[model samples]
Target chain A: MNVVDARQAVTRAHREEWARVVAALTRRFGDLDIAEEAAAEAFATAVERWPDDGVPPNPGAWLTTTASRRAIDRIRRENRRDDKQREAQLCYDSPPEPLGAIDDERLRLIFTCCHPALAMPTRVALTLRMVGGLTVAEIARAFLVQETAMGQRITRAKAKIKAARIPYRVPSAADLPGRVSGVLAVLFLVFNEGYLTTGPDTDPVRQDLTAEAIRLTRLVRDLLPGDGEVAGLLALMLLTEARRAARVSAGGELVTLAEQDRGAWDAALIAEGHRLVRERLAAGTAPGRYQILAAINAVHTCVRDVRDTDWSQVVALYDQLVRLDPSPVVALNRAIAVAELDGPEVALAAVDRLEPDLAGYRAYHATRADLLRRLGRSQESRAAYDSAIVLAGNTAETAYLTRRRDQLG
Target chain B: MQYLISVIHDDSTLATPDEMAAIDVFNDRLQAAGHWVFAGGLAGPDSATVIDNRGAEPLFTDGPFLESKEHLIGFWIIEAPDLDVALTLAAEGSKHCNRKVEVRPFR
Candidate 1:
């Protein structure tokens, strides 16, 4: 292979195999920091050597073996402690077994990283780092945090896991529901960090983050195919991502769902997402938050025009979602649907009640502005729009809210 | 795994006779289920004292470690396989004691 082809092969291998190699090493060493470091060193070696010697036939296995050997070497050199000696022996003696088609090692790593004992932010950082194979710098950049802060957060989380003796395994069937939700929440939050960008004048779509979330979700679903909520979450993400192409106009302006061309939507993703939701619903499992949200999105996809949208069905799904997860954000979304079904006057009352909880949220102010404008309360609408404009982060949202305020004047 | 179920309550409060009876019944249930390790109730926080030894000489002080309306009134060290079991037992304990309970696993 040419130098460029070798580099491309290594990059592809890193993307596909980072988690597997790290997970295998972690399973052997029983230490996340060591495993991660070893895996990173393996990749660095690959970057330097692959261009000279070309990529291996089974790159994942090659990386796993390389990382494991490196870990053994490091363990031997670091200490003569009993535990270190035992770990080094294990790493040196164990042979690389072929992983199952489902890759349970990666699933175990996911569950461990998303353990309930860890704080939620730690869970997100760990998931992004260990499972998504994102660099600390990349994750920090994505979240708009300082690299040192992000690095310290991940280090503290790993220390907590070790100090607390959090087990490295998938939860039992009884504990699966609670534990799996933590994992799913991390994945969804990562996607949202990408999907709902608040950066000024930047590309709103974060295809990399969203794609990674979906990829990890698929891995989790394959491991737990019978899990309705998993299917529901994947379906929700896929359905939401299907509109990536149409959510923004060619001029980089925000396109409301009503104005976006349906032709720009990804039909394959929509179909797959709809099928997953339908299958999960048809299985007669009680609908969870993701299921309800996916059903709501499925309703949106059913109609060509926004006017043809089934507002009643959307409102009913939101009602169910509010029951499932009564967060302020969900309540805000439900209010929007309530406006569609009951009219802006009633929706305004609902929004007002949510003020104590959501007053600082940009979407809350934006929603209130829209409702006020619909009610023909131009003065109140302008004030609400002003608050929204001040709170808005991105140029698209600020521009849109500014236009609304100017129109009211 | 083992967990401590701390029953927190107002420092000056005391359980009624009815509440004590309910707690006894809940204790019997825990023992029967083989989840019970040990249980005890503390005197009001007024009887507590604090000791600080970071200086050259240990200094003894009279007062609870924390000045607050609430204190750890009682606690139970229970043995269970995992957090779920410990939390379920804690829920039962909370209902029986008629008090808020906090559950934490022994590290």
Candidate 2:
């Protein structure tokens, strides 16, 4: 194969086989650090050899075998410990195993990576690296952190998992609900990070990451077909993704829902999202955070024009969500909906009560700026906009806030 | 695997009679399930002393090693297969003792 073809083949192999190879090795070796490093080494080897020898017939199998050998070698070199040595000896040259329909290995890998024992940020980084097969540099770039610090974060998390003996299997039925939500939270964070990928502290819109988040969520949804929140999260991502193109202007400023061209949204994604939301509604069970949020988004996407949007239905959904989650952020979002149904005076009263809780939050300032501007309090609105612009992380958001502040005349 | 579940309290306040009864029940359950290794309620940090012998002259200090509002009031070492089991037990332990608890695995 030529160099370009070989490189393309290697990239494809890395994307497709990285998780499987890591999962299989993790099962065999029982160490995430070892499994991750070995899989990376295997891919590096593939890069070196595939160009000369051509791609293997079963690239997944080839990568798994190569990773297994490397893992055993690592065990032999660094470990004089009897237990590890025995495991290495037993795993050496083990035949490749078949994966089940949902692939228990990958599920177990994800659950372990997103284990509740780890902090949320750590869980996101670990999930991206182990489950999404993102390199440390890519992950750091996406999140806007130093590569070394990000590497240490992953390393420390792995060490903690091993040290704490965090189980490497999916949670039992009793634990599934809580554990699934934790996994979904990590996935949502990744999706949001990608969706709003640009900010002073982040990179420009990383659609690739949003796509990865959707794919992983889809995998989880398939694995737990009966889960409402899983389906809800997938639906939420799809619906939000549908408007991504119109959400940003040609000048790279954020386009508010009122200003976005409704026709520019992806109809197919919106359709699929609505279907899932409807399905959840039919499930008859009280919805959770994601489901409620999905329902809210559905209410928005259903309208061809923002003027035709159903504000009361949106407010009702937010009321349900407020009951489920009384967080300041949720309260802020509800107030935004309240502004649509009630006037700025009523929404401002509710938002002002949240000031102590949301003093440093950027969205809080932005919302206040909008509400104050609507109330004709231009000076206060300008000050609020200034706080928001200073706190805004993305360049696009900052640009949007700056324009609003400058338009006070 | 073993975990140390340390009960934390902000004062020298000991467990109430009802709490003690609940803890006794929990201990019996742990023993029945083969999860109990050892457990005890401490005498509060007021009874603790800091001892350092590595220095040429042995050093001694009054009270706990660190002065803090919250202090470890009790601890239980339980055997389990993994963190999940240990956490469940610790969570129950916290409920029985009616105080916050921290679970740390032994190396």
Candidate 3:
């Protein structure tokens, strides 16, 4: 194969097999750091050699075998005293299961990474590195931490896992229900990191991270098909991602949701997401936070245009969301929806009530500014816009707030 | 895996009679479930002694392992398939003992 095609093949394999390869090595060597390093090295070798030698038929298996061999060598060299024990451990490993059967290795890796004993940030970082197939640099950039710090954090987390003897297995069925939230929270954070771009010039969409989160969520959904919340989370992501393209304009400026070109949204994604939400709702299980959010987005996508949207239904979903989530951000969103259903005065009152809770949140000020401007309180609107501009991290958001403040003049 | 469940209690207080009865029932449950290995209550920290042998000769001292108002008044060593099982048992142990329990798996 040509170099271009070879590179694309390698990238695809990397996305599909990184977790599997690393997991295999981890199971064999019983060391996460070594497992990750060996898997990465195999991938690097593939990038260099695949152009000359054609891509293997079973790339995942090839990577896993190569990584396992490297791990065996490393273990032998590092612990000569325990060589016999290591060898005995490898000798009894179960043969690879058929390709069609469920691969529990990736699930085990996810559970181990998101173990509650580890700190929340450490869980997110470790999950991104191992399960998401993201480089330390990519993860560091995503989280806005120094590369070395992120690297150290990952190293420390791995050491903690080994030191604390966190088992490399999926939780038992009884424990599974409680642990799902932690895993879902990490996946959502990864998606949000991709969805919420920090700078104007950076690509509005980090498709790799978003796609990775979706893929992982799909795996989780398959593992827990009976779970309505898992389906709801996948639907929520798809629906939010469907509007990603429309969230920006031709010149890299922020497009308010009310003014976004709905036609630009992905129709296929909307359809799939709407279907999932309906199926989950029809399950008639008690709705979760994600299901509630997905139902809200489903309402937004159902209408032909923003003005035709059902504001009361949107407000009602937000109300449900606030009861379940009860966070300042949800309150801010509910107030914005209230503006469309009720009047600016009522929305303004709602926004003011959240000031104590959402004092540092940029969206709170931005939403208040919009409500104030609608109420003909130009001076207060300008002041609110100034706070939003100061708090805004992205150039596009700051520019949008500046323009709104200027318009109030 | 073997796990150590340490029941932490203030030295100023002792277990009530009802708590002692609950703990007896809990211990029997652990024994019946095949999770009990060994367990014991410790003397107060003030009556403890420590010995250090890293030096050229042994050094004897009259204090607990570490100085603190709350100390491990009792502990249980239980075998379990995994941390979840150990934690569950530890929760019941704490409820019976009427004190906070700290659980750590043996490395």
- Number of the top candidate by lDDT? 2
Q: Which prediction has more favorable DockQ, 1 or 3?
A: 3
Candidate 3 segments exceeding 4 Å error: A79-81, A84-103, A197-207, A250-252, A392-395, B7-21, B40-74, B94-100
lDDT of 2 by residue, A1-409 (tens): 8988989998998777787889899888888999999999999999999999999999999999999999989887776666775564344442332333344788889999999889999999999999889999989888878999999999999999887888777777778889999999999999998888745645457798899999899878878889999999999999999999998899889899999999999999999999999999999999999999999999999999998999999999999988999999999999999999998999999999999999999999999999999999999999999998877576778888999999996
Error of 1 at A99 (Å): 18
Best by DockQ: 2
Where does model 2 sit among the CAPRI classes? medium
Over 4 Å off, model 2? A79-103, A198-201, B55-59
Pairs of residues at least 3 apart in sequence or in different chains that clash in candidate 2: A199-A393, A199-A394, A200-A393, A200-A394
Best by TM-score: 2
lDDT of 2 at A380: 98
Sort candidate 3 into its docking category.
acceptable
In order, candidate lDDTs are: 0.85, 0.89, 0.85
- Estimate, for each residue in B20-102, the C-alpha lDDT of model 1 and write its tens digit: 99999999999999999999999988888899899999998898988898889999999875554666789999999999999
Identify the runs in model 1 with alpha carbons over 4 angstroms from their true place.
Answer: A81-103, A199-203, A250-252, A322-331, A341-343, A349-353, A392-395, B1-10, B15-40, B51-58, B65-107
> Which 10-residue span in candidate 2 chain A carries the lowest summed lDDT?
A92-101
lDDT of 3 by residue, A329-386 (tens): 8888998899999988999998999988888988999899999999899999999998
How would you encode candidate 1's per-residue C-alpha lDDT over A1-409 as one tens digit per residue? 6889988988898788998988888888878999999999999998888888889888898889889889988887776656765564354332232333344889989988998777888898899899889999988888778999999999998876654456667666666788888899999998887787777755577888899999999989988898888999999999999998898767666777878899889999999999998898789979888888889999998777889999999998888888878898998899899898889998989889999998888999999999999989999999999998888576666777787799995
Please give the distance, in angstroms, between residue A124's alpha carbon in candidate 2 and its true position after superposition: 0.9
